[model samples]
Each structure stands twice: as structure tokens, then as C-alpha cells.
Target chain A: MQFTSEQRLDDGVLEREFTLDGIPGVLWTPGSGSAPAPLILIGLPPLGLRKVYARVAARARYYAAEHGFAAATIELPGSGERPRWEAAEQARADLRRVMAAGEPVTDEIVDALVLPLVERAVPECQAALDALLSLPGIGGPVGYEGGVISIGVRLAAVEPRIAAAGLFAGSFVPAAIVEEARRVTVPLQVLLQWDDEANDRQAALNLFDAFGSAEKTLHANMGGHTGVPRFELEAGARFFARHLR
Target chain B: MQFTSEQRLDDGVLEREFTLDGIPGVLWTPGSGSAPAPLILIGLPPLGLRKVYARVAARARYYAAEHGFAAATIELPGSGERPRWEAAEQARADLRRVMAAGEPVTDEIVDALVLPLVERAVPECQAALDALLSLPGIGGPVGYEGGVISIGVRLAAVEPRIAAAGLFAGSFVPAAIVEEARRVTVPLQVLLQWDDEANDRQAALNLFDAFGSAEKTLHANMGGHTGVPRFELEAGARFFARHLR
Candidate 1:
């Protein structure tokens, strides 16, 4: 891991930009000279780091400032400045075409779009975890926070370092990913927007049910997509505190 | 309202047993003397107060000692040493018979069992609220927590003092009560036990969907009806603190 730039926020959080195996990412650590703060690995949607940076940074800062945790996120493959894959682009085009035609999005289209992404993203996240946990002041057990539900499911299922997960509920999950969800035994907190037009609520609920975790909670709130209430951020922090601390 | 007995808990919560217009109830207030603390009117299941007193009083003491909120609950009509009505008894018998025979519980049976209870309970609860709030140290914007969800829906719908509610999701809600739920505009937090064998999960979800409150949240946890995690008690306290304080 090679750090490209560094800056300190007013709240005493140290923000560092880094690249591991040519994949760009950012890490935030608490400032209190606490020997090693527990880490939270945030997951971003396919939206690039630059587009989601401000929002994700605010959450990272909250964790650092108020909750005393280190937080980090890496760009998903084929997003941000990373080169796009041909098959992924084709899948996106198909998805767009189906939605534009006002036809039902078939399972094939969803699988084509999400499965490959989850396949590539999960390994990259694990690699990033390896790099982050190796840092001097960042420690585990780590937590995984909101992003694409499929990727979060995969990571929580396979990654032993991740003791818990707080997932943002979304649709387009492939059947394979739902099956993978059954392997995730870590405690989970899932946030769902009740009226998210871009998502299917029942599918989200079903995915929540499929998790193998004995301790899982689904917090469904009234709103469209992008309307998760601010209070949930603190709730997520407390949840991680319970497990990670 | 007549005070039957009063005692100070070990945590400095003042617990008082009372009866209003011949109906029995209990109230707990913070001993801090921070005059006029906000209140939470706990709703009890119709199982009678003695049966549920220890559980509910623990919750009340939690509110008073930890959150600086007064809490109260009155026995439901035809329950807890109160006079039993034959109609409600018959409905209960019918309900048990159907469940024993593995027959689906029809809406008629549900309405018969719950509607009259709600009709009698809501008013008695309101009268209890009137007496409790009239006391010097307990104040409003009140919250209603748990118990029979239909009674909560009606109280939150028509009771102006009830600013928010935390409902324990249960079945047996009549369609009329479901419509009444749409009239409840207060912020709500509905707790659901996902694998509760006695309650219909889909019905709970649908009722959560029907609430008119723009600020409703559904917190679905894994477990059976009696298996709500202990952490949720604190979560419910924090929720009421957000709205009531």
C-alpha cells in the first residue's frame, strides 16, 4: 500500500489517500493517540469515490470524532477512475434498455449486472482489508458498513475479520448472492428504505431473512431511496461499538 | 385517581400503584426532582397486571432512572382481577379453538376479541393519562410503548397527547384498527419478532406499511415472540428520548 496524500480534518481525524495494487482508496483514523482503534470498512456503491466521497467522508469523520474508530473505503472495480470492463458495461446497457422499455427486470439481467461485480469486488475488499489491518494504528475486529447489498453479503459471509455488518438494503441481488447470504453468520444490521422505487421491498426483506446470522436486525424506514434518516448513522456506530469494542 | 401504595426503587425511581375510577394502574417517576419530566405510557397486554408487572415495571424503571421519563400502565379491561365480560371470554375461547384445530383465525373472531377491548382500554388509558399527567412531576409530550398494537394504533390516532409510539408488532388487529393505524400520524417505531410463530410476519409488515406517519421505522429482529433482544430496551429508550425530549 502506497499513500498518495495526507490531510487532517478539524476534528483530529487523519485522512490518508492510498493505492493498493493500483486500486485507489481512503482511510480515516481517530486522532486521540489511542494505540489502535477498531476499524470499520465502509462499502460504497458502484458510484465512484469522487461522487460519494463527501457523504462517506462525513460518516467516516463521525466514526472517528464521536465513536473513536478507524474507517476506510476503496473504489469498486470499473468505477471511479478505474478502467471499465466490457461485459459489465454491456450488462449496464441491458439494464438501462430494459428499464427504459418499462419492462420487468428479469433475473438474468440482474445476475448479469451484479454477479460479476460481486465476484471482483469482494476480493478487492479483502485485499484492502489485508492492507488496512497491516497499518500501525488500525486494528480489528473490523465492521462492514452500507454499500451494494450483494458485495456486503459476500464479504460478511467469507471474511472472518469482519465481526459484524450494517448493510443498506437494495435490490438486483442475484440468486447466487442470496444463497451466499445464508453463509453469513456474523451479526448484521440492515437499513431499508420502505418506498425505494429503485428497489423491491419484499426482495430486501427476503434477503434479510436468508442471512444465517442469529443476530440480525432489519431497520426499515419510510422514504424513497437516499432517504435514510440521519439517526441510523449513530445507531450503526453503536452497533459496531457493541461488537468491535 | 387514588394512590394505593408507593415505594422507592433501589435506583431512586418512585413507583406508585394507583386506581382511577375503579381501574387499577401503576406509575413510575424519576426521583431526580427534575420537575415535569416527559412521560411514556406503557401499554400492557390483556394478560393482567400481576402477570406482567415485573416485566413492565423493569421497563418503567429503565425509563425513569436512565432516561428521566415517567412511565405508567393500567390493566386492560376484563383482565387482571378486573370483572370479565362474557363476550370477550367467548371470543378468547373461539380464538383458542381455531388455533387448536389449525383453522385460520378469521377477522370476525379477531374483531370480536380485540375491538371491544380496545374500546374499553383506550378510554381507561386516557383517563389514566389524565390522572398521571395531572401530577406535579410527570409531564407531556407523552409516548406510548408496546403492548396490544391495536390499542396503541387507536391511542396514537386519537389521543393528542401521544406524540410518538413504539409498537410491539402483533397479530389480531381488526381491519377497522388497521384503518385507524393510517390515522396515526405520530412518529412510530414498530418492533417485530421475525420468526414469531404466534404472529403473522406478513401481516406485521403490511401494518407497518399502512401507518400514516411519515417518520415510521420497522425494527425486525430475528427470534420468536418472546425473544426480543435485551439491547432493544435501550434502543427504545433512545427512540423515546429523541421524540419526547
Candidate 2:
């Protein structure tokens, strides 16, 4: 999606939607600013930019307004205007079956469902970055945060434009992602819920450990998958403010 | 299982089988040695110590014979003669389903399957440590290796009995295991196969990164899950010798 249209949201941020070759995305920019601003790219939660992740999704715009940063929320491949892939359906079915049977899942199944999306997402994010940074009021060395940490992991490894990343340790991570994380020299902040049933605790730790970053922190608290404390979110805001600001 | 039977194996190692309350296990000791030897506790692979893991199971005995160490191998809670828990059956079914459907599995399923075994195995390992240390040719500050790194991770955290550990980053690791690894200050060596499909790469990195051991080393190689090279095994043996011998 080329930078398509812009609308003023009630919150007063300039919300612009884009369709990168068909994939839909939204970029939030601080109102009344044509001056170049720092860019922050956000990957949405597992449910996409839905009710479950509205607050998280708003983080980009929040940074745009309060921190004088420009932020973008790109849709994952097979999401929004992009045609959905069969893998999502298959993954959903598999989850239903496994949950019903109450079985242990091998990583093989997970890779099949997620690896393609991540593979597709990485390039799309790069394209999104290319589009966003070229727009008015945008600059280089981007910041990234949110659920699709796989994209963040790969971007941090391969994309020099990403200055810093905050990864949500709440999804199925493959070995390739961890290996890629070893190449991530950018500063990182990983948020983990100790009792997150869906997230692999070891995997989260492994990704954090593999980071080549000289400066990194793991914000782990004892809670369910989405039960991150408000204080932690504020602390994360401070982290972004320190680095991205 | 409590220590019940002790027999001499053909290779001049005293073999003993135990059933701790309900769990079953075997211990091997250097033959004709009343001289207290440093202990090496072996954690079994996901595959129970059946014909599939016979060679792997002989590790403790080999360490005992070749290194003059008293070694013990404890069965996981549901292995050997112990009644398989419903959770284990559910986990197995789930793994099969996910493998068949070729879906990426959530760590929730892995946790559901492995967490109970790990929880039960940790205390049993502590008890095994207590019982084995009371026997002749047994000593404290032991070396631990192999799959149930969960037990190794836990024992390394709470049970000061473990002096060193050789962690095989080849199985499903829970979040608690990573948290426990953070508390593991004992000298440690971790083995990883770079392309292990079943193992989550990020989790392995997380667990390795979380280890608090100042003297820790990650012996990672390019191979599949079980394709560990002979030289690597020798290197691991050398690691154990340096720490336990």
C-alpha cells in the first residue's frame, strides 16, 4: 500500500493508512509537525490490531504525540487487505484439536504455521520502513515493539535502520529467530509474563540471551500472558523515551 | 523409588535400581571403589530409557566406569514402572496432532505436558541426591547432564548439591526452568544442535542466556536434534571431568 489517505483521529494524531502492495497499515504522526521526527514501527499482538490489543496498538500514536515521534503499525502478511493464507486456518484448526485432546505440541507444527508469516512479514516491514521513512516528518534508525517479535528479531538482525526494539515475549518462537537474535546488536527490551501459558519461557530467555546487544533488559513479572502491570508499561515507556526519544 | 536392588554390571560398575515412592531410577557406581567418587546425575531424554535411548541411557554407567565417578540416572515421574499420568498421555496426543497437522504449537501445550513431570522430578532428584550421598563411594557437589535439564535447572537453583551441570538444550523447556537457570550460579556447559527442529531455538538461547554461571560455556554445533558429533561428546566429557573429577 502506497501512502493512501490521512485522517485526524479524535486523539488528534494524524492517522495515515497505507497499502504496501496490498497489505494494509497505519502510520501515526504527531499533529502540526512537518519537521522530521524519529520513527517507531510497531508489530501488533496475536489478535492483530483488535480489541485485545487496542491499548498496545495505541502505543505508537502515544509516542508520536507525547514524544514527538512518528510511528507506524503495519499489518502482518495475510492480514487486512492482503488475502489471508490457508496456514492461519490450519493453525486455528490445529489449536482447536490440540486443546480438545489436551496434547503436547511439537515445534514442527508451530514452524509450519508461523515461519511463512514471519518470512513474509520481515520484507513487508522493511518495505513499510522504506515508505514511512521517506515521508515528511520522518527520519532513520527506527524503533520497534509489539507481538510479532519475530519480525523485530529479523529486522534488528538484518535491518540497520532499526535503532532499538522492545519485544513482547508472548508467542511461539522458532530456532531461526533465536539465531537471528544473536545478530541483533541494537539495544533491546523484552517483556515476559512468568505464567504466560502460550509463551515458551525458555525460548524467551534464549532470545534475550542470544541478543548481541551491549545494552538489554528483560522485564519479567509473575502474571498471565496479558496481565502486564501498568507500571511495567510505564517503565517501558521510559525505556523508549530514553532510547527512541 | 527407594534404593532396593544393587547388582554388578558386566563392565565392572555396580548398578542399582530404585523406586522412589512411585518413580523408578537406576544408579551406577565405580566397582571396587570405597573411595568416595564425585557423583554425576544423568537426566533421561524425552524418550524414556527404552531401546530407543539405550545408548543414551548408558552415559551414567560410562561416566562412572571411565571417570571413576559415582553416577546415577533417575527416571522421570511417569517413566519405567511408574504409572503414566493423564497429563503425559494428553501431551503425547497433542504432540502427535500438531506434528500431523504441521502447525506451530503454543508453549502452553508444551508446558501442560512437561511442567508436571518437571515439578515431580525436581523433588525426586533432591531425594535421589540425599540417598546417593548417604551411600559408599558417593560425594556431594555433583555433576548433572542430559534431557531433564528441568530437574538439572531446578536442582541447580535450590539444591546446593549440584556443583556443575551439562545441559542438553534439546527438549521442551518451561519458563520456570529459565527462571531457575537464572539462579544457577554453578559452573555449567550447555550443548545445542543448531538445526534441531523439535527444539525452539529462542528458548534454548533464553535458557542459556539466563544461566547465572560466571564460568558457563555454550557448546553449540551445526546439526539436527540428535546429530551430536563424537568430538562434541568428547568435549562434553572433558567439561564434566574438569568440573566433577
Candidate 3:
């Protein structure tokens, strides 16, 4: 409810940057809201919610404004405005040592090191949803959206409130998510860049197959990381409109 | 190669146990060697070259005996007869800490911690090949085979000395292996139990797709990890026969 600043993007999307209940976030609502709008909860891209994801945020805004929805991006726990967890630093150090020795990043190391931070992140996402949904002019059904896509995967699996999901397959999936995917029955739209150099294409495909959703579609294009085609993004926005609108 | 014990497994397969060049191994050659025959380098199942993997070892022996090939199993650098790598334990402990905190195992963790151990394992495999090829009765083309499966994945990617590989898709894949898989042009037969609970099904399928080989066949059956039927094993043996014989 309390925004530190409010600005109008060139395209007329209303952007309000806020530190709601100690969680930092940016909310994009229509310049002229006439009724409660469907909400799109955007996860941080791999580069965090910074300049790198500006186009992403814009896309979310453009889609929402065009489709009569609201899009919001929050700082997950241990990221953005929040302080980094000590364990994350330790995990990074552990990773560096193993990489120096030319070892593969194994699951156990992921479970121990990176999992904790993301697990904590899940709750933070829930909190962001709570805060965003309660805003004066923000409303209607909510859909989980965006990349670093595993968090979206986790949210869709556990949060029954998520009416739909549009996932970007650009992150490593933990084994737990494979199990989680089996429990996710929500309608989903998973987009993948077929040849992302930094991504394990197999893992992405595996997570997509694990979804228990009968109404899931995988949209894949041959591109590297940061090379997701615009057509796919439109397809995803169209999907959310069908489900969430 | 010096033997410590020899046994006949009721099927005319001669099994010889030995500690050659500080590596513990079991060598199985058919009771009849009419001419110089092929050698199959069998990797260990998730269990070391221990009692649990005995049946697996036996299957290799039985196949080798029936098909007029020589099969041998060797303990990897960190399992069975070899001293454990100190770094692996530290990595495991690090993984435990993260998992205890309910973290999702991410790819970076695998790259840092597990890669070194598996990287070390690759050379040990080469060493085993060098030793196996040097034996009096062992001869002709060599096929690298085994599971938990990434070891086989890793070996197939790098060891051009291997004429053929029968990889079991029953383990998590590090991202590096996806890159490595591209380098594996060896004629390959990859086996998978389609419903393996402990295995990441997506990762398995992805690695299979990543292989650059034109002669690769995916032998997937509808079953759990331990439920791969006897017929599939035979099919794998048949593949080796076609490629390595």
C-alpha cells in the first residue's frame, strides 16, 4: 500500500516501487484501473530483477496492460534489497573449490548449498503474493510467471492459489522439483530455448514432462540464453489471458 | 594380472578376482576362447563393485561368456578397493548442510563438488582399459559399460579408445556431461527404466538427446530403476555384439 515512488513508463504502464512489509518489489498496474485486475507474479530472472531484466519487466507490463492484468516483481529472500544469506556465500565458495578441482556440480552439493536459499525464497514469493493481492487497485485471480524458472516451478507445485503458470525453462531443476512437478495440476505454459548454452536442455525437458498438468504446452525455439524469441513471449501472454483473464 | 580366487558361476563363465596394479577387479572370460575376442569394460553400479552389484557383474560375465567376448569389472578410484578422495567427503558434508536446510540441489553444486571425483574416475576408467587390454586372454575391440550412469556418459564422451558404449540412464547428469555428450560419436546403446524413482527422468532423456551419434539407440522400458527386465539386458549385449564383435 505504501510505495516509495511512482513513475509512468513511456508506454503508460504505472510503475510503483515499494518496500512493502520489508520486502522490496516493483508493481505494474494499468494507468487507469477500473476494476480488480488479474495478477501476474513474476519471478527474478537469473540476473536478478535489475537492468538485465528491464525488458522482461517491460514485457510483463506490456502484456498485462494489453490484456487487462497486473504484473508484479518481488525481491526474493536473499536477493535484491535483502541481504545475502551467509550460507549462499559458503555455497559459492564450496562451488569454486569443486570447480577448481574440475569436478561436476553434483546434486548433493546443490541440495546442500543452493537449495536452502531457494527454499527460503519460496516463502518470500508467497509473502509477495499476499502483499500484491491486497493492494488497493490490484486484484483478481493470480498466475505464477517469469524465469530463473525453477522458483516458478516450485511455486506452481506448492501454492494451490496459482491459477496458471508460464514458466521459462532456463534454470537447473532439483530432484524435489521433479517430484513437485508430478503434483502440479495447474494449467501451464513452459517456454524453452532449445539450445541455451548455460542450460541443461535435458533437465529442462525433464521438468516439463514431470508436470502432472493435463493442460500444459511446451513452446521451444532454437536459441541461446537471452535469445528467447519475441513470438514465444506473446504466445505465453496469450496463454495467461486464456487462463487467468 | 594376478588372481586371488576363481569361481565358476554354474554357466561356464570363468570369474577371476585380482588386485592388479593396486586396482581390485573381477575378470570374466568364456570357458572357450577359440580365437582372439572382444573386451567389455564394465563400470560399477551405484553400489561399488560390491555384493549388490554382483548380479550386474554376473550379467556382464554371462553376456560375455555367451557372446564370445571378455568382460572385466574394475573398482573406480574412490570405490571398492581404492582410497576415498578427501575432497569428496567435504563436498558431501557441504551438500548435507544445504539439504538439511531444505535447499534444492542446483547445477552449480554438482559442477563444483561432484565433477572432480567423476573427472578423477574417467582416468581410472582409462587405466582399467589399459590394464584390461594388456591381459593375456582379453583381446579385440573394447566396449565401456555401466551405470548410476553418468560415469558411462562421461566415458563415452571422452574415451575415443572405446569402440562402443552401453550407457544405463539411471543417474543425475551434470551440465558438463551435456556438453560432453556432443563429443560422444561412438556407436551407443543407452538403456533406461522409464519410471526410475531415484533418477531424474528429464535429465536422462536430455542426455540421450544430447548425444551426437548417428548409431545410438535408446532402449527404454516401462519400469523402475531395479525393474529393467532380463530381455533388455540381452538386447544391450546384442548391441555390443553388433558394434564391438
> Highest lDDT among the candidates is held by which one?
1
lDDT value, candidate 2, whole model: 0.74
lDDT per residue for candidate 3 within B65-153, as digits (tens), equals 68878888877666665788777667766777877998877776666565786777778778877877887777758898875466777
**Candidate 2 TM-score to native:** 0.49
Candidate 2 per-residue lDDT, tens place, B73-178, comes to 7677777656777888889799789878988666887788778877888887888888778876688668888766777788788888788888888567777677
Residue range with the least summed lDDT across 10 consecutive positions in model 3 chain A: A45-54
Off by over 4 Å in 2: A1-5, A50-53, B1-245
Q: lDDT of all the models against the reference?
A: 0.93, 0.74, 0.74
Whole-model lDDT, model 1: 0.93
TM-score of chain B of 2: 0.89
Residue runs of model 1 more than 4 Å from their true location after superposition: none
TM-score of predicted chain B versus true chain B for each candidate: 0.98, 0.89, 0.91
TM-scores, all candidates, are 0.99, 0.49, 0.50
Candidate 3 stretches with Cα past 4 Å from truth are B1-245
Q: List the residue pairs that clash in candidate 1.
A: none
